[model samples]
Target: MAVKSLTPYPFAPKDTVDKFPAPLLYIGWEDHKLFCSPVCVPMPPTTTFGDLVRGTLPGIYSAHPDFARIDWAQTEWFLSGQPFTPDMDKTLAEHGIGHKSAIRFRTPGLTGLNGSCF
Candidate 1:
């Protein structure tokens, strides 16, 4: 479905990078319905991808039973729907991840809670 506005909807987007103190990054765990949707978080562009995976992600996904079981070596990653291999030590800006970029990852042997896709 497409929306047909009767009048011009001219307004600045509230979520634009300039409005935030830091860039916003979206992340999701594939096959995990418990989250239902990706989570958006503000992070400095200087933050390393490793910190994102090892530090930030844990804080958000630790509630899931499979989170602790994931093997980082076997995980697959995607950025904006394209396969991505991140350099652990590189900053987000160095990897071209700007504000509003989305990153998704899948654990090879893990598929939701009890394999229920939840």
Candidate 2:
């Protein structure tokens, strides 16, 4: 959908990275219907992928019953809808994750609550 303006004027977008304290990172757990949409979190570009998974994600997705059972080694990761393996120790910036990048992960054996996908 495109918005048409009667008067055209150049203006900077408010959601640009410079407007936030940190870059916005969108994360989602695939096949988990509990969260209807992905979560947007402000994160430093320098934050390591390991910390994002271990320190950050737990705080957000731990409430899901299947969270604790996830096998990190087997988890499938996607960036901007493409499959990619991340180096745990590398920073998000190192992986080319810029502001508003979407990161999604799928737990191989865990679909959703009781396999209901919800």
lDDT (Cα, tens digit) per residue for candidate 2, span 1-118: 1468889867767798988999999999999999999999999999999999999999999999999999999999999999999999999999999899999999998999899863
Top candidate (TM-score): 2
Off by over 4 Å in 2: 1-10
- Cα shift from native, residue 43, model 2 (Å): 0.8
The TM-score of predicted model 1 comes to 0.89
Which stretches of model 1 miss by more than 4 angstroms? 1-10
Q: Give the whole-model CA lDDT for all candidates, comma-separated.
A: 0.92, 0.94
**Ten consecutive residues with minimal summed lDDT in candidate 2?**
1-10
Q: How close is candidate 2 to the true structure, as a TM-score?
A: 0.90
